[model samples]
Every structure is written in structure tokens, then in C-alpha cells.
Target: MTFKVGDEVTLSTRAGSRAVVEYGPYGPNGDIYLVKLLEGDEQGEVFGALARVMSTPVFRQGDRVAGFGGTEYSIVAGPFTAHDTWYVVKDDKGQHHPHGDDRLTLVSRAPKPVGPTYELDGVTYDLGARYRDKDGDVWRFEVINGEPRGGMNGKDIYGYSETLAEVQQDYGPLIKL
Candidate 1:
């Protein structure tokens, strides 16, 4: 439940991805930390979560899992997409199934994967191609990781997925369970 400032963690109860820990582990009100979400609708804003629900993801491709008396399975997928998404897992006998977000309790997450990334002022931003600085200026990138990166960099770093409903048509489909 303890966390350092740079730790990437998830929320056990609901949608969250490789969000960064911005502050706290404060006592007196149960250990809590403020996390800045890197994806989904809440990107760039700091929110709080009890330390109990925050932990380093320990699962990776090909890891083993088992229910109390259920069949053994292997993780055939990665972290949930858009925070609250599900995982696509496979069983020992070779069958892929989409498991609920809660099923992640059987396993944790591995380090956050690096997708499309760009840098400005030495700080690297991922997932989204556009970003706004503390000064509230908008900037755009024509390409990142060889793919078209779209979004608005004003007020906040809003990804194309957040700003546009036609994201799949332009950016391609997101990872599904």
C-alpha cells in the first residue's frame, strides 16, 4: 500500500490505467494518494484513492492464474484499455476469454507499456499526441510513432479519443477485451 512519488498504479474499484502518483500517503484519514490519470476522460487531473486499492501491476503476458477451485489460466493480454476495460485471457488448454476488471485481483499489472510518445520541455507525454503546458497554450504534432496524432492542447491535453467520437475511424480501434 506504500508508494513512492514516481510509482504507476491502478484503482482496484474502477477505471484507471498507468496513472502517476502526484502526492500523499497521508495518515489520519487512511493512507491515500493523489494520482494523475494518463488516459481516459480524467487525464491530467489529480484524484485520490485509498492506498489499499493502489498497487503496482504484477501481471504480464503468459502469467498463470487460478480461481479457488476453477481452471488454471494464462494471461494472454495486457492492461485494460481506457482504464476500466477488460482483459483477454486464455486458459491452459488454449482458449481465450474476456475477463472482467475485477478478475485482475488474481494478477497485478506489469510496468506501463509505452505507446505513442512525444516530448516537450523534457517531459514525455504518451497516448495523446497533443498537450497543453501549465501556461495553457495549445500545440499540435503532425505525427508521433509514425501515426497521426490528433487532439487539442488547450485547457488540458485532450486525446482524440476524448475529443472525438470518430476516433476509431481515424485512429483505428482501441484494444478491446
Candidate 2:
């Protein structure tokens, strides 16, 4: 199969080695290709390999994935090559890190939003509604002046169930007014 530049592929001759298609297939049948190795001792080295010797990568950049057998998700930092299986991940403390792709599972590219309606204390609250938290702090459950309130930061409130109980179960409790 023909491969393009930036495509992460494996080489038949180097079994498990990852490389990126750098240059052309100048041979008569367009089978020859120049690939740069992405892993091992020869990382950054280039070589000429036949089309039959190159296979496409299993994962691509921007793919949402989970690693370490955890529920937290991360984005693929780049092409999944032997050397850079790094993922753009954030820890519990909200710190970013490059995580390895061991036992990684692909997740949906984006989560489904739970909509702007929330039910609490037999009352329904929509976006921009004011609510009191357990700490007695009042906040609007909407984006105010381009800023998020009531812990409605994109990551904190979006993609959760529409029920207040469900949201509280995941993101701490918020008392009803």
C-alpha cells in the first residue's frame, strides 16, 4: 500500500519498529520508500524500504484514549510510533503529563453533552439559573461574562447526567436554594 508523509508505519524487516514515511517510492513500481525510524537505537535514522515492508499505524493523533486501566481519558499526542506512544494526559491534581500507551483503550473523540437542564429538589433549573452550593455560596449555573460559575467549567459540568444528584455524585455536592 502507498503511504504518505507523516504516516506512522511499521517495517516488516524491523518487526515492531515504528517509522514515518518521509520521502518517495522512486523505484519503477513505486514500491521503494524512505522512512525515518522513530524508536530504538536507530531512532531519527532514515532508510529505504519497500512498500510491502511498511504497514500503517494502529492509532492516529487526536484519538481519545485511556491507559493504566483507569477511567480518566487522554488525547494521543501524536502518531503512535514505537518511540512516542505519549499521550496528552492530566492527573487528578490537574497536572499535565506524557503518559505511555500501555493497555490503552480508544474512547470517543468527544463526549455527549448532558444538555442545559438540571433537576433538583423537584424543580428544574436551566442555564443561567442561580443556585446555592453546600458552602452557601450562590452561583449561576451558566457562563457569565465568558467565565464559568457554579463549577460549570467545561470539564466539571459538561458530559454529565442531567440530574443534580448524578452531577453531585461525581463533582461534589451542591445544595439547592
Candidate 3:
């Protein structure tokens, strides 16, 4: 049971997202364990999964996940009501999503498609607005190509549905996906 300062590990038994062990009661017999997540999907929406310990953890505290190249974001006061409680993330640039790049331009589409489909664990899923945390850090999301995807931020997890009417009432204005 040898863990390092920034060792990437999981719950080892439960359905937990991947995270880096921040501090491990590290020494001989510490009781509590501290860690920060490494990889995840469906921000704001919580999914169920079990802990499968990682053989190796990739990123760390000093490592950046927002594609900002090593710029660590600080999670300040959030839960902003504009859309939800948005965090006060202080950084050079706001969060960056995996799609907002030269290759995958998230430009609005005319007569936008119903929504983008994201398949997870062999099941197809549709989501609305993909959101970020306080620091402009885009989340692990697949945005709609033409329209905004609709869904709830972490504070608004009740905003999801396979029904178009339900999605429209809850997250229609957010995104096409």
C-alpha cells in the first residue's frame, strides 16, 4: 500500500471518479485521505460508477486540466445564480472546453440539430448546455454543433431528461446538446 504525494488512485471499491491523492494520511497509519479528481464526465450531472483503482494517475495539483497548459484554477465562491451558482474563478483565461478549439469549433448552427449524442458505457445520452465551474474551466462535455445543449449546472442537477418538452422547459436556452 505505498502511495505517493500525487498518486493517481480510486476508491478501489465504489463507483468513484478518478482523482489524484492529494494527501494520504500518507505516513504509516493516517485515518483520512485527501485527493482531487483527475478525469470525469457529465459535469453537474452525477452518474453512478464503482471504484476501479488506477494503475497510474496522470495529472496533479500543479498540472492543469482545462487545456490552459499547466495553469491551475482556484475554486472560489460559486453557485452563482445567473445560470446557477457560478464560481469566482480567478485565472488568465476562463475555463476551456475540449471542443472550443480550431478543430472542433462550437459555433452556433442554424436550425440547430436536436442535440448531440454522447454514448457512455454502451448507452446513448443527450445533454443540454455544457457548463464550467467558477474558473472558466470548461468541463468534460460534448457540446452541440449548432445549438446550445441544455442541462443543469452542479447546483441545478434536476435539469435533464430524454423528453424534448422536459428538456425545453428546463434547459432549452442553455445549449443545443
Per TM-score, the best of the predicted structures is: 1
User: For every candidate structure, what is the RMSD over all alpha carbons to the true structure, in angstroms?
Assistant: 9.9, 18.1, 16.2
lDDT of 1 at 101: 48
Model 3 lDDT tens row, 1-177: 345566655543323334565665533454445566543343232232222233232221222223234444433232122322123433456653221121221122224224466543454545422433343222223344433333332222222422333343443332322
* TM-score on alpha carbons, each prediction: 0.41, 0.34, 0.25
Give the better candidate number (1 or 3) by TM-score: 1
C-alpha lDDT (0 to 100) for residue 45 of candidate 1: 77
Q: What is candidate 1's lDDT per residue for 1-177, written digit by digit as tens? A: 479788888765543344788888876974988888765444677888787767675566666665436666777775554444456778776888877545555544434444465443454545433334333323334453344444432223233323322333444333321
Q: For all candidates, what are the clash counts?
A: 4, 0, 27
Give the per-residue lDDT of model 2 (tens digit) for 34-151. 9987654466889899887677643455456667766565553443344444456654556666666565677755453333765556656665454444443333454444433344
How far residue 25's Cα lies from its native spot in candidate 2, in Å, is 2.2
lDDT score, candidate 3, position 65: 26
Predicted model with the maximum lDDT: 2
Give the candidate order by descending TM-score: 1, 2, 3
Q: What TM-score quantifies how close candidate 3 is to the native fold?
A: 0.25
Error of 1 at 4 (Å): 1.7
